[model samples]
Target: MRKAMPAALVTALAVHLLAGCAENRTAGAGTDTTGAEIPEKVSAGTVIAVGSPETKVALQLSGQIDELPFKVKWVQMSGGPQCSEAFRAGELDVCSAAEVPSIHARWTGLPTKLVAAEFRKDPHRNPIYELGIAPGADIDTLEDLRGKKIAYSPGQAQGALVLRILARAGLTEKDVELVELPSTGDVYPTALGSRQVDAAPLGGVNIKRFTTKYGKEGGKTIKHGLRDDPAHLWVPTESVNDPQKAAAIREFVKFWARAQVWIDEHPKEWVEGYYVKDQGLSREDGEYLVRINGTSDIPADWDPVVERHQKTVDLLAEKTGNEPFDAETLFDRRYETVAADAVADGRKGS
Candidate 1:
C-alpha cells in the first residue's frame, strides 16, 4: 500500500523471522533449556542437560542429590537424535544416550565428547534391546526378515542393534525395507499393532508393554544377543573446556553411578515410582523389567570400552559404505579418574 518493500528484501526478512520463530519455539519445550542464562560457573547458573526417564528416577532416588555442587535442569528426551539436536543448538551441555548416537555425532564432526560409559552387569539375560515381530507376521527368525518392513530410527541404539542383527543373519540393509520412524514410546506399538511395520526394535518400558499386550500367541520377540553397544554420557566440547562445568559433570557422574546402586537395591520402590506411576505400566510389568533388566554399571576405564566401540564403528562403516573413524579419538578421558572414584564410592554406598 505505502511503497511496498522489494520482493527480495521482503522474502529475506520473512526467512529470518521464520528461523527466529522456529528457534524460539523449540527452545525449552519438551526437554530443552531455552531461556536460562548460561553460567560462567556451575554454581552460579543452571546447567541444562538431557537424559532418559531413568535419569529422573536416579535423581529422585538418590537422596542428597539436591545438594549437588551445580544446578542441573534436566530435559527428558526419548532417544539420541533429539539429544543431538539439542546439543547442536547449544541448548544442552550434556546428554545421556546409547553408544551409536554418540559415535554418529562424532562421525558427523559434532563438537561432542563421550564422558562415561554404562554397561549392564548381565546383558544377555537382562538385555535392554530387542526386535519384535507383528502378531500375524510370517517372520520367525532374522533370516525371514528379508524384504519385510522394519520400523527403524537411524543413529539411535535400536538402529545399531538392527544392523548388528542383520549382520549376524548375513543380511544387509538392502535385504529389508526400513520404515524410518522416531524412537518414541508409542510409535513402535502403533506401527506393529496396525501392521504398518513387520518388525521393530524396542527398549525400556515399551518392551514390557509390547510383550504383555501381545504375549507369545499374538507376537514374538527376537533377542540379538549383542551387548557391546553400551549407553553413554556425552557433553559439548565447550562444556568440557569449562572448568566449572567439567567439575560439575564429574560430580554428576559419581552421583549417577551411586543412583544405579540405589535402583538395584530398591527395585520395588523404583518400579512403584518410575514404571507404574510415571510410565503408566502395570506394577507386574514394572517389577519384571526392574528385576530382569538390571541397572547399568558405570565403567571408568575407556580402553576396554573403546575397543568395544571400535567394533561398532567398523559395523556402521561397513553398513553405510563409509570409511571408519577411530573410536578412541572420539573419547575424552579427562573424567576417567573422577569416574573411577565415583564407581568406588558407589560400591561403598551399596
Candidate 2:
C-alpha cells in the first residue's frame, strides 16, 4: 500500500506549480461554490493540474500545448489508482483513465465524475489487453480459467476485465484463486513469467515483449474476446464545481477530443512521436501498437456509454459483493457533447 502524502506538502506543491500564472484574472474568474453555472471562458489565472502523459505527448508532439488558453502543470501519474490518490490529496485536477477508476472512486466514497468518454472504433479488434498464460499453465481457452490462479487488481481495469472474462466463461470467484497484485509497470508480466499466477492481462508493448521472451518456455497469449476498450477523462467533482477550473476542464476536453482525431489521422507521426520517441519503444513495436489500437471513437450521446458502465458496475458488484448504484451519477452530462463537437469541428487545439 502507498503511504498517504502530508497535507502541507501537497499544498506547497500546488502553490509552487501555480505561482507562475498571470496575476490578473479575467472577468467572472472567482470561485463558484453554488454549483449553479460554470464559466464559459477560462480565466487568465486558471492553472489546471493534469495527470495524463499520453495527452501531454499528443499535445506536445502536435504543437497544441503552445496554444492552450490557460496554464497546465503536468503531474506524473501512472494509472487510475495513482490519480485517485492525487485527487484525494487535492493535488490533481483532471486525469485520463479507464472506466474502472470512476467506479472504484465512487465505491470508495470519493466524489469523482467522468467528464468525457471514448472507445476504440472496433473494440473487439483493438482490445487494450490480452490474457497472458503462464509458461507451464495448461490453460488454452477462457473456460480453462477455472481452478487457475489469476492475478487480480480490484480497483483497476485489468481486475475488472478478469471478472468479466470469468463471467463470460460461466465461472465465479470461488471457481478460481484470485491472487491480489498491482498491475503497474512490468508487474503483471513479471508475475506471469515467474508462474506466480497462471494467467494475467497484459497491455501495450508488454503483450509482444512477454510472448517473445517466454514463448520458448511455452508462454502464450489468448484473446479475451471481450470489449475492454474504455478511455475517459475524469475529475474529482470539486474541480467541476469551481468555475475557473471547470472552464479550463471544458476547454481541455475539447483539445483532448481533437487530439484523438489528430492521432488517428496521422498514424505515422503518432507512432514516431508518441510510441518511438516519447515511449522509447522500437519502431516495429510502435507500429504494432498503432495497428492494435486502430481508431478512436468519441460518441455524441452518452446514453449507451452509461448503459455499458452500468453493466460493468453490476458485474463488479456481483463479483466483489459491493453495492450496485446507478452508473449515470458517475457522469457529468453538461459536457456530454463537448468531445464529439470538438471532433466534428476538426480543430487542432480548440
- Across 136-243, the per-residue lDDT of candidate 1 in tens digits comes to 888888889898888866667777788888888888777887777766768987788778888998876777678778876577687777774487778766666656
Name the runs in model 1 displaced over 4 angstroms.
1-53, 215-217
Candidate 2's C-alpha runs over 4 A off are: 1-35, 347-350
Q: Mind giving the per-residue lDDT tens digits that candidate 2 earns over 1-350?
A: 22323323432454355333312221122342434666878887899999989899899878899889999999978478898778777789899899998987766556788999999988898899999999999999999999998988877899889988998999987788888788898998998999989999999989999999999999999999999998899888878878789889999999898889888888899899988898898999999999998899999999999999999999887766567999999898888999999998875434
Among the numbered candidates, top TM-score falls to 2
Which lDDT values do the candidates have, in the order given? 0.71, 0.84
Cα deviation in Å at residue 25, candidate 1? 19
Q: TM-scores of all models? A: 0.82, 0.89
On the 0 to 100 scale, the lDDT of residue 186 in model 2 is 96
